[model samples]
Target: MFGRSKPLELNVLVLRDADVIATALRTALAAAAPEERPGLERAAALVEQAAAVPDAALRARWVHERLTAAGHEGPVDSVRAVKTLRESVPGLGLLSAVQLTKDAAAHRP
Candidate 1:
């Protein structure tokens, strides 16, 4: 007898979830020093923008721009930053953890 396959589930960020991540980013940003706050603020703004866009590609573009603006460097540095954020703030989900580096890579020059 053939076994039934399990339904596939996409672990992506819904528009509403972007706000949750932004709130977490804001909380993290608030605890950062004034010198480090600007970068965090830029990222939070991008996340807020992503929340309003329904398209994944557009949201990814926002994440890419935020990563580059925040001086995330190449893919390795970008991935490291996302990992650090996820570890430091458990509320950040997997989609957010990979969004910067993965999408940025596609949009990188």
Candidate 2:
């Protein structure tokens, strides 16, 4: 006879709005230890500030800043930049990552 096994259950919380994320962070902050409170508070504030910006704009800015900081600009190491973009920005399509990488390369000083 085969042994009985428990069914697997999954719970998922999707945070589509920045306000929702900030509220969750705030809730976590109330119970966070002294050492962890600062990080949670800062995350909540950042989410609130970013709430006004569209997600696409935020992703673009982050990609630009990361590529620039990594010195992957001006067509140099562009392949790596694409990889970095895809890795840093989850769910970013490959074509979009390539385009952003190319655009960054073109705008390099």
Using TM-score as the measure, the top candidate is: 2
Which whole-number lDDT from 0 to 100 does residue 101 have in model 2? 60
- Structural similarity to truth (TM-score) of each candidate: 0.36, 0.37
Instruction: Give the Cα error of residue 84 in candidate 2, in Å.
Output: 7.1
C-alpha displacement of 72 in model 1, angstroms? 33
Top of the candidates by lDDT: 2
**Residue pairs of candidate 1 with colliding backbone atoms:** none
lDDT of 1 at 89: 45
lDDT of 2 by residue, 1-109 (tens): 5999655432212235887788789889999999998888889878878787654455455567876676555553367778876776677666777766664454543
By summed lDDT, which 10 consecutive residues of candidate 2 come out lowest?
Answer: 7-16
lDDT of 1 by residue, 42-102 (tens): 9998987867764656646655555555566556335576765456545757565565446
Give the true-structure RMSD of model 1: 11.9
**Candidate 2 overall lDDT versus native:** 0.66
List ranges where model 1 is wrong by over 4 Å. Answer: 1-16, 55-109
